[model samples]
Target: MNKLILSAAALALMAGAATADTVRMGTEGAYPPYNFIDDDGEVAGFEREVGDELCARAELTCEWVTNEWDTIIPNLVSGNYDTIIAGMSITDERDEVIDFTQNYYPPTASAYATLTEGADMMGGVIAAQTSTIQAGYVAETGATLVEFATLDDTIAAVKNGEVDGVFADKDALVPFVEEQGFMFAGDDVPLGGGIGLGVRESDTELKDKFNAAIDSMKADGSLNALLVKYFGDETAQY
Candidate 1:
């Protein structure tokens, strides 16, 4: 599921269809804290709660849908989903195809995680979730990039001796370092403007509703509360 594979799939999905009301919110449930399925077999995470409240405030009936991260944006274009609430950043390249709501999560740093120390994140084999900023960054670096469909797969590559390290959002990898004995390697790569909900180019009205919902939460400090609840107080101030 590299960029090339995604482009072909996106074209095919775009020709299919779109949905009616009942906003179909798409996400990569494999990334923890931001989004993941809990033990109850339900979508339960920070973005889940935030999305629900935003839909509530916007008076839009929404349902959660988990899709692979690599094809998430393609599926959005193809009409498989109405919105992407995954931990995606607001980037110029992505905005060319999709509209984004005001950021819900502030700008974040991407870091490398490895099972051993002295790992060369700059040039060694690096695993990253396909079609992500981290993956793009890895390609720019001299490192050999190994693309995986999910964040879990990238981490597994490191643990299973498939790659030297995995690159991803620092916050998303923090829990693993704390609990799984993984070590933080190399300096953090400052990537992403901020995390936002993504919608198709034609859906201006839908984007506006979600934007208003986000602004409402920000103004009321509810968004800050959720940031602390899920990401801890020391996270980016914005």
Candidate 2:
């Protein structure tokens, strides 16, 4: 849920319930380890596995659909998909436009990754994906915020010296720091409530079904296992 503006009440009038035989699950299939396209040209990531299980538990037939992250919520409102299973953090600004299930992913921290150690994270130019919480934070916290369409672009910015560092999910940045020689420049910044499934307000039934599935996963400890599977042992769990 990026920078969407429609109110939930208005969106309720625009979007219908999931009346199709196959519910379309929307995602930005670009953010690795969360949701991303794989070698076989299919959506394959933590969200994909979790979504399939949720659909099975809810007895809902579901399929995946890819969309640009910046427009994912708006397209949902326009009836492009039935649910958003992307790694979208629940926040009040987004809640105003769409409904969210109880968090499936635990709250995590955002961090800065720089090419060199001890880069001035707060005072120097920073890159973050457009319409993301990290971008908003950079814009508000006095850093010159340069945003891109994809997470890869932000990382490239850091590599090419286009910016001082890239601010993004710590989990998402770990691989770059360890393998690409980028160094974390500052303390992690905890933002958002947690990650959840997004739906139009009118689809209360769909929301309830996903929430129940998430609850069952949490109760059974399978959700934590999946989190650990993708994010490693140090990842925060339920």
Candidate 3:
């Protein structure tokens, strides 16, 4: 009888340990105002703050890790990260590989041309990051597509006249064009996806927790507050 009691206690303890959740979050720290490294070398941005709030709401300890943009999803699938809080778009193509939590943010794509006299004449080729929904849009629109590795590179190509215009996330591109003296075209293009938290397909429980936390934040206006604080009132979607 004692042995049976001991076995049950051991199993209970193991179960408790298993449920001590730790959410390992991944992001592209290079994207400013979304997820970036501050002067203190700590991750600080809109996405980071949102992720921290979600973790608190979900009662999980979170560890923020920086991963390259291209590898974020693959790393999550390979068990290198438990969650992806990057400004990753939710697309049907991505849904085939991983599950996404409720959208915490909405992002649009727009085209920006260099500040030149005939910039309006430069309206043929559109540039975007390779493998992104923006790139797919460019392709579907039949625009001459120029692919770059990073957002900065795409903007640089536009500035240097290598491309006619650059298509990118509205939040990032707006500030970038203002700082770089580029002119934003009035395209108002819609992207093919929405931004959401990413998780492995096997992590249904974690995904549900994240979705609940996001829903709560959205209801309480915390998500909108963060969006306004970082991207301004024009960018607020929820």
Candidates ranked, most accurate by lDDT first: 2, 1, 3
Which lDDT tens digits does candidate 3 get at residues 92-187? 999999998878987565554555545442337778887778787778765688898777788788878788777777788778667878777756
With a 3 Å backbone cut-off (N, CA, C), the pairs that clash in candidate 1 are none
- lDDT string for model 1 (39-88, tens) is 99888899999999999999888888999888899999999989999999
Residue 187 CA displacement from its true place in model 2, Å: 0.9
Candidate lDDT scores, in order, read 0.90, 0.92, 0.81
Question: Who wins the TM-score comparison?
Answer: 2
Residue 71 Cα positional deviation in candidate 1, in Å, after optimal superposition: 1.2
RMSD of each: 9.6, 8.4, 3.3
Cα-based TM-score, every candidate = 0.89, 0.91, 0.86
- Better-scoring candidate (lDDT), 1 or 2: 2
Tell me the TM-score of model 1: 0.89
Give the TM-score comparing model 2 with the true structure, all chains together. Answer: 0.91
Write out the backbone clash pairs for model 2.
none
